[model samples]
Target: MDKDLEHRFITQLEKHQNIVHKVCRIYTSGQDEHNDLFQEITIQLWKAFPKFRGESKFSTWMYRVALNTAITLYRKSKKSVRGDHYEHVLNNLKYNEYNDEEEQQLKLMYDAIKQLSDVEKALIFLYLEDRSYKEISETLGITEVNARVKMNRIKSKLRTILNP
Candidate 1:
């Protein structure tokens, strides 16, 4: 990459690293898997960097690549992974930054999201991140109507999971 583009990529990555972290958290239940997914996302984002035109916000494009990388990486690695360590990590994570109720709710929310299909999880992640239907539709190559419908379904599923 050229100097200007390399600088821009680093700047964008710093700004949007949280998106990759969040996706990795949702897609990979274990620390090792999460780190692997993060690396995969970084690599994919670098590869796709040149194709990023100024048409959409950089974060929006990053979300697409991050989600795609998370799903693909998870699928490719799922068979070899075991989940015995996940509960231990979950227990170790300190949520004292938030109130007890809020922390519990956040954990429950992700637990529910973990059960979703890859497509549903991607839709929910983007929706929760507050992306517009148009941006999501463009990123996912779906119609705006479909994006809206998928988000509605994801919400309903979450409601069922949380309420049940």
Candidate 2:
């Protein structure tokens, strides 16, 4: 990449790193996998950088790239031997600072979310992040009606998991 484009990409990346991190956390159960996914998303974004037009908000474009990278990574990882290690790794992962109740609730939510299928989980993640139905549709290449249907189903699924 040229210096000008490189600088622009870095600046854009810095502004949106949190979005990448949030997606990483939602999609991966293991810290190592999360880091790997983040790197993969960054690489994908850099490669696809030239295709970005100024018509959409940078965050919107980012959501598409990050989601695509994550879904693709998840599919590939599913076929790897190390994929089965996530449960053990997640059980041992530590969090330093949440209060007991908050931490418990968070873990419960994560557990419930992990029970969902990949597509449902993606819809839930986007919904939780407050993406509009149209944007979710565009990101996932589904119709707006399908986005709403999936989100409603995900919510019901989550409720069952949480309340069971």
Candidate 3:
């Protein structure tokens, strides 16, 4: 890549790196795996950057690439230790309780989300990010209707796990 292009890519990536980190947290367990996935996503982003047409928001494009790389390249290991960083961040949520009741509830919700399949996780991640159905459809290569249906199912599944 040319210096100008490389500089631009780095600047844009630095601005949106939090998107990468969030995807890593959702997709990987264990610190080592999270780091590995983050690097892999960055590499994928750099490779794909040359082709980015600026037709969408950079963060939206970044999410598509990052989510695809994570889904394809970073299969969670069976022996993987769940990442603690998620809980650390959740611990700081405004609603966190001194008695830790909210913390416990969040832990249960996170565990339930953890049990979701990779594709479902991607869907929920996009949903939680407040991506429009059209954007989720574009990112996931599904129809808007399918995205909605799948989101409904994912919500039902999570509700079952969290409530049961």
Candidate 4:
């Protein structure tokens, strides 16, 4: 790629790298797996960049590529811990702002989310990120109605897991 294009790609990647990290968070178990998946996603994104048509918003496009890469690689790892070790940055920061009860609740929620399938994880992650149904469907290549339906089901599933 030319320097101009390379610079553009690097700028976009740097601006939206958190999307990739969030995808990695939901699909990988530990730092090693997370780093591996992150690198693979970057490679995939770079390979696909040349063909990016700019039809969709860059962040939306980034999410699609990141989610697809994470889900695919996550399925291929036979011994995957399946995001069981995933932790929010807040906890790692040792903020001490949240009490023990809040921390416990957050852990329980994370545990329930970890039990979801890869696709479900992707869906919930997007939904939690405040993406619209249309955008989520676009990112996942599904219909708007399907996105809403799946999100409802996922919420119910999480409720069951966290409650029962």
RMSD of each: 7.7, 7.6, 8.2, 7.8
Highest lDDT: give the candidate number.
3
Give the CA lDDT, 0 to 100, for residue 119 in model 4: 80
Residues forming the 10-long window of minimal summed lDDT in candidate 3: 89-98
TM-scores for candidates 1 onward, in order: 0.79, 0.79, 0.79, 0.81
Clashing pairs in 2: none
Model 3, range 1-164, lDDT digits (tens) per residue?
A: 27677667777877788788778777765667777676677777777888999999999999999998887775644233244533432232232112324335456666788899999999998998899999999999999999999999999999999888
Q: Report model 1's TM-score to 2 decimal places.
A: 0.79
Report the lDDT tens digits of candidate 2 across residue range 86-109.
343223323222123543557778
If both were scored by TM-score, which would come out higher, candidate 1 or candidate 4? 4
The prediction achieving the highest TM-score against the true structure is 4
Candidate 4: global Cα-lDDT? 0.76
Q: How far does residue 46 in candidate 2 sit from its true spot (Å)?
A: 0.6
Q: What is the lDDT of residue 26 in candidate 1?
A: 82
- Candidate 4 collision pairs: none
Looking at model 4, report the run of 10 residues with the lowest lDDT sum. 89-98
Each model's total of backbone clashes: 0, 0, 0, 0
Name the regions of candidate 3 deviating beyond 4 angstroms: 76-106
Model 1, backbone clash pairs (residues 3+ apart or across chains), number: 0
